[model samples]
Target: MPRTALAPDLSPGEATAPRVQGWCPGALRPMMSGDGLVMRLRPRLARFTREQILGICDAAMRHAAGLIDLTSRANLQVRGVAQADWPALIDIFGGLGLLDEDTGLESRRNLLVAPDWVAGDDTERIATELLARLDELPDLPAKVGFAIDAGAAPRLLDDSADFRIERGAHGGLILRADGRVAGVPLAAGAEVDALIALVRWFADGGGKVSGRMARHPAPLPAWAMGDVAPGPSAGALRSGVHALGVVCALPFGQVRAEDLAQAVRSSGALALRATPWRRVLLEGAAPDAAPRLAPGWPDMDVADLAGWRVEACAGAPFCSQASVETRPLAYRLLELAQQGRLGAQRGAAPAGADTRTVHVSGCAKGCAHPAAAAVCLTGRAGAFDLAFDARPGEPPQTADLGMDAVLARLGVN
Candidate 1:
């Protein structure tokens, strides 16, 4: 394969300026990170067949660095591909039915489907309808997305989305925007039409300037707002078995490609489904199959895996903006949990509380976990700034401490 040409003025891996990109990467248009080109793959209805997953794993090992990241939008991103290998990789992806017709449609089809939806369910139906109408939508910002969370209750409330189709107060459907508390009542089969109208309204009414529906200053039209409120959340999915399948956690939202392929094959799962909570649902897999799927995969009934509670980004050499290597520190935190010293660690939650209390960012951007964590360690100039009960970039409780000093401050031995 031939390499894509870089700018004439800049050599490979050299840039005149440092900046974060606003657009998300896709199969056709990948983002260049410090490690390599990052290509994102979005499966239809957030699912992949067993064969498709196997093909993905094989391709990653041959073309990239064999590393795969499960994104918060319930998508998969293959990291560390060289410029010369992208064309072949894209061909593989297209054969697997993963690519859109073109980059324009690819960028516009940012839909997040409820992972637990069964075939022919309302969630699947709505998502399928919306996907077919992608060409009708006006150009949207790269980050703009839609959520089809019409499960028994909303499951994607915490995930990012601009427009949402969720269950109404009375079990009917409703269309709501990200920032608002209310939603417009939606009739069955009219979900897609309602969504298209809402999107056009946003685009024509100065929403392009704001870039996000939540940040758009214009008030929604009166007809777009109704008294209906979305149903209560079903809550985050954990590493366990459910009626539909087995849910397995991906430590820090990452997995080696071979391990994933092995897990899928071993479980005899008909397909794979992704959730924003760093978990994967093996559709049609037996409830007891989790323990036997793959090594390092968390099975809730077997043993507690502290990696599920921690969020860390690709730090140091993998990311140009990072000054510290984050995963190593994150692993040390896991070691503390194994040593039974986790409770004494600062920001440790009480028993029965949400255990995902730690966030280790490569930089203040907080790309790994956007929500506030009980403890956030932001990298700065080869050291770390510790913040308790806050997000990254907030004033830290303590600043400029080496790793050892940080552990000492946490009262670690």
Candidate 2:
């Protein structure tokens, strides 16, 4: 494939200017990041064919920074694009059927489907139905989203969402509001209607404090049903008739465009699915065989619990808001934790303490993994402030620890 020509006289200030906080980026209007412009593409049905993947890779290398990021919402972003090249890049994405004809429609289509959904399954059916009715939904908060998790067991509860349509215990469809335990029982034919009604209720009666369904203060509709039991923890890899592929992470959720493009081409899989867990699902390939396609690809096995335990933001030079680099530190911490180096020194955590997960944020904003972690590191003027199982902005246990000191505290020599 031929490379696209770069637009002339693009400057750093023009390309990397800050964007509105909480505003999501899309192909039509990309957000400016520390690197450059970031154009996010949400693949319909959370899927893309091999051809689409290749085209995206080519476009990224040709017009952007040759880097692509898999977002927590099961979307892909081509980062570090020049301001001048955005038009050509958007044109390329449209050619790949990646852009919605109307930008409004694209923004409203924040739906996540079960990555392992098979043809004719409840997940696929309901997602398709809901997608078609997106025009009917009222204007919602930019970050508000929905999850369609109709697998035998739910796989997206940990993912951020304002509403969810998941499998009920009795094997029926249930539409549940986020941050609540119960959901209204929905029959096969009425799922879409119930979802729209709930969305309407939120728009009409929800409080001003937060647009999220969890923060809404109004009473739920009378049609609401039974309490929802939480699903089993998401395993790194799943093997079933519906889900037969491997799930792998990008070292702190960053990937070179070329590396991913080469892997997909070599895998021979027809499609790829992004997961909210900072992983990619290679459909139609065995777990063991898929990793061979890309050298240095980290395919997390079921037993690799450490790999599933760390989350970090794109810090420092890549994010204008950041004061330090996050991913490199996260990678180091993960290595030490996996080797039992940290565990050996700190001893077993208190019963019920969350010792498995660690979150590294670039600044106090905590853009990545906003929730508390077993060990949290927030950056401050190139050093770090440490906290234990606490949210960002909470006072740190120890302040202003340099990189070496932070590593020492983690018991990493």
Q: What TM-score, computed on C-alpha atoms, does each candidate reach?
A: 0.79, 0.77
Error of 2 at 309 (Å): 4.8
lDDT against true structure, model 1: 0.79
lDDT string for model 2 (120-163, tens) is 89888889999889999988877788999888888887788888
Q: Candidate 2: give its CA RMSD in angstroms.
A: 6.1
Candidate 2, residue 289: lDDT: 57
- Kindly provide the TM-score of model 2 when superposed on the true structure, using C-alpha atoms: 0.77
State each model's CA lDDT, in order. Answer: 0.79, 0.72
Alpha-carbon shift of residue 273 in model 1 (angstroms): 0.2
Flag regions of model 2 displaced more than 4 Å: 1-20, 207-209, 225-243, 286-288, 292-294, 297-330, 343-411
Instruction: Give the clashing pairs for model 2.
Output: none
Q: What is the lDDT of residue 72 in candidate 2?
A: 77
Poorest 10 consecutive residues by lDDT, candidate 2: 1-10
* Candidate 1 global TM-score: 0.79
Index of the highest-TM-score prediction: 1
